[model samples]
Target: MRFSASEGLRTMLTAALVVLLLRWGPQQLVELSRVWGEWSAPQQATAVTYVLVVYVLLRSGRGVQRRVSWHLSAPSATALRAGSALASAAMPSAGGSLSLERRARHEAAHVVGFLASGVVVEEVDVRVRPDGSEGRVVAVDNKGLAPVEQAWGYLVGAVAGNVQDLRDGVHDGGSAVDMNTAQSQVWRVISCGVRPAGYDGPLTADALFEGARARAGEVLEQHRSAHEAVAARLVEYAESDSRVPLSGKDFDDLGVGRVPADV
Candidate 1:
């Protein structure tokens, strides 16, 4: 009860401070906005030009941000994603290397899945679906895309990334993802026949999903190695002054025509 009372007192004091600041802040801001009205004509022109320049710069910044994340993944999507990440932060065990950031862990895990299942990750980017849902889309730069963009292979990687126990095959789907639930979600996507543009139907969907799942399980064994590689590459990319081209077919190499796969 004492603790609650103290907390209440603190909250009231903070609220009082906010009220006081609000009471004192408006007049100064009002004066600042009016000072511009008294400027000489040349000074007014300069001020207007400055405002326009600032506006242009803001627009340019938005454009650059849009280039990375727009329709598929809005820049604002991070607001949603970061909130979840913060709410679900989990510290590692005593022996587990704590150096890996959550992003590094997720990127490493997903990258291994990408390599094993052949998801083609040269230009993977976040995007929003027409259904108003957010997800990622990876583009293959031909060099990285497997000859056969098997829907099952990609699906298996995704499922494995979602459900696999990264810790020691004994985890309960840490804050990152839930293994059992992840598997179920993957199955639902397949059963619903809602394949993405490239991974559409052949009848091999069911069989391939199972095969991919099994293959992904094997790939999980190399999670540590994969995680390490991901961390290294992430640092390498950060230091390098380069960008991955977003061109090329989503399911095939540049010169190589659409390589056929069995769904």
Candidate 2:
């Protein structure tokens, strides 16, 4: 019920990866152009535009996350690792504002889920679990984390494909096809869980060769940590807002006494 800290880190890492790929891919493409001189000026322009859009969206999202952290108390500094305002680059712009609107809704849902998860936005109580994990709502809200995180993943993967197309020459051999496949693969990994929808969890030559399930599982693991970090930060936010002394009986009530209070 709490946000997964690992998911936050995964989001940040994914954004960073996308930014790096978006920036570097174009540079590589441009350098390749010098040698190949195959792509026309229009093609070059389009490639550059795609790369720029991805990087810009990621950066913008990071900025917005920072700003909101400064102003709000629920999401917390976890934005540095697990937030999604900038992932909007992945959405379709031509579909009017529907995509953007969905992103907004998801963002709100994320914040609300954190609050609803017992963050106390004001207080805390704690009970230690027999398993040694503290019983508390100090975690960030990661409920439905898959949708938002996967959406961003899809965007990054798509940008990677677009870049690859430019590098390989979209018209050359199977360049465009490869790109499409990679993009689709990325989406499937994100959307279809550790396997594609209706995949029946059975391993086959194609699945093994594709490594789709393995890759998706890896992503999910990464996301798990980011979500936890985010959830912890949300607890910190609650502590800060409540102005409660984190070392007292009330702290136990708010679920902070049993855990290390490292906001």
Candidate 3:
């Protein structure tokens, strides 16, 4: 990679300093001090200039390195969302008892959550296996969405799934990964200076998660019709090929819309 002129100078000076220290040890500093006292005025001026230039270059280089490292290590919002989807999909069905219909509804709820939260839904699908069933919704472009909104997007699936289970008189086996991912999103938002409403306590994962969970329920209730429509379509699609993914156009065709302005 190309480096700026200051960085190149800093590298050269750092190498020289290391070599000098390795060869001469602490005595070199004493020797340099003695030489500085004996030097003429012009010589002292030149040496001071060199030291100042080296110091500035080295400090700037450190700042540049820090920025590069941070950029390399920090995960983007899109990556986090995609990872959450993958984790949710890979989680085994609780007790190996979840039905294909339930899996579809779970993923459909996630799709509605994404749409309502202004997240882009690419596609969603479900797979049926003898052991259990799995479902996933592919979403992207959540960069500008509020942390609570993104957290809600991650959480709605579990809340809706549990609600469905309640209606069916079945025990709820919520996805732990979904809750963990939602909490992570909440933490990220708080770190970035966006605090969720009604949370005045010290920041904690559970607190952020509970706040997001409550909001998810509210949003889900508001968009219940859209969620039901998407779930019904997902069930119908499963009749032919359970693995086929439903696209954004398919959701749009089903009349899925954004979350209400007040919400």
Error of 1 at 177 (Å): 4.7
User: 129-237 in candidate 2: lDDT tens per residue?
Assistant: 2222111112222334444333323322223222322222332222233234334434434443454332333434354324433332333233334324433543453
As for model 3, its CA RMSD to the true structure in angstroms is 11.7
Q: Write the per-residue lDDT of candidate 3 for residues 88-192, one digit (tens) a residue.
A: 344444545667777666677677666766667877776655656666667765667665555445444334444444444544445555555555565565565
Structural similarity to truth (TM-score) of each candidate? 0.34, 0.18, 0.58
Winning model by lDDT? 3
Q: Highest TM-score among the candidates is held by which one?
A: 3
Residue 94, candidate 3: alpha-carbon lDDT: 50
Candidate 1 global CA lDDT score: 0.42
lDDT of 1 at 215: 55
Winner by lDDT between candidate 2 and candidate 1: 1
- Arranged by lDDT with the best first, the candidates are 3, 1, 2
For candidate 2, the TM-score is 0.18
Q: How high is the CA lDDT of each candidate model?
A: 0.42, 0.34, 0.59
Better of 2 and 3 by TM-score: 3
Candidate 3 local Cα displacement, residue 105, angstroms: 1.6
How many residue pairs clash in each candidate at the backbone level?
Answer: 6, 36, 0
